[model samples]
Target: MEQKLLNSPQSEVNVIDSLFAEMVLDKALLDFRKKKIQQKIDQSLQDRNKREFLRLSEKLKDLS
Candidate 1:
């Protein structure tokens, strides 16, 4: 049965592969977004924007 699915033109294997790739991309995007938020926090800290820094920190916590 597994072999049959793999051999079929419209295969479960292709669907699984596509879903896996999409999952990987989604994870990468989340990670990138977290990093960008961190950078903003760091900048806010340097520029002494206390309110903005706290807001970004809260966003970071939510992401994690």
Candidate 2:
């Protein structure tokens, strides 16, 4: 850190502002990726359930 920046209030404010912005951006990116992953997981579960249901139905039909 520069000695001049340590003595300057404006420089401190600027550093804080930049850090805050970076944190906000990181959080937003994390949220977006989380949502995408959850969507994929949900879709996979739905597909598995449908396949299971179809298999059971076929088994029932063969029993008739």
Candidate 3:
């Protein structure tokens, strides 16, 4: 890692870009899971399933 830092400036830029890309991917995945869980919660509500609704609600809250 020290050697890479001592290398050219282009290497540093590449490292930074990769880190940013990873963060974006992570955020997208989290959003997808939260959205899916929310949908389930809504369905549970429509079906009048209190147990499922509460469970899904907790799962969604944890994501937030």
Quantify how close model 1 is to the true structure by its C-alpha RMSD in Å.
Answer: 4.7
Clashing pairs in 2: none
Worst 10 residues of 2 by lDDT: 55-64
The lDDT per prediction is 0.92, 0.69, 0.92
Question: Between which residue pairs do clashes occur in model 1?
Answer: none
Candidate 3 residues lying further than 4 Å off, grouped into runs, are 1-6
- Residue range 1-64, candidate 3, lDDT tens digits: 4565547898988889999999999999999999999899999999999999999999898889
TM-scores vs. true structure, each candidate? 0.79, 0.65, 0.86
* lDDT for residue 40 in candidate 2, whole number 0-100: 56
- Which runs of model 2 end up more than 4 angstroms from their true locations? 1-6, 49-64
Q: Which RMSD does model 3 reach against the true structure?
A: 3.6
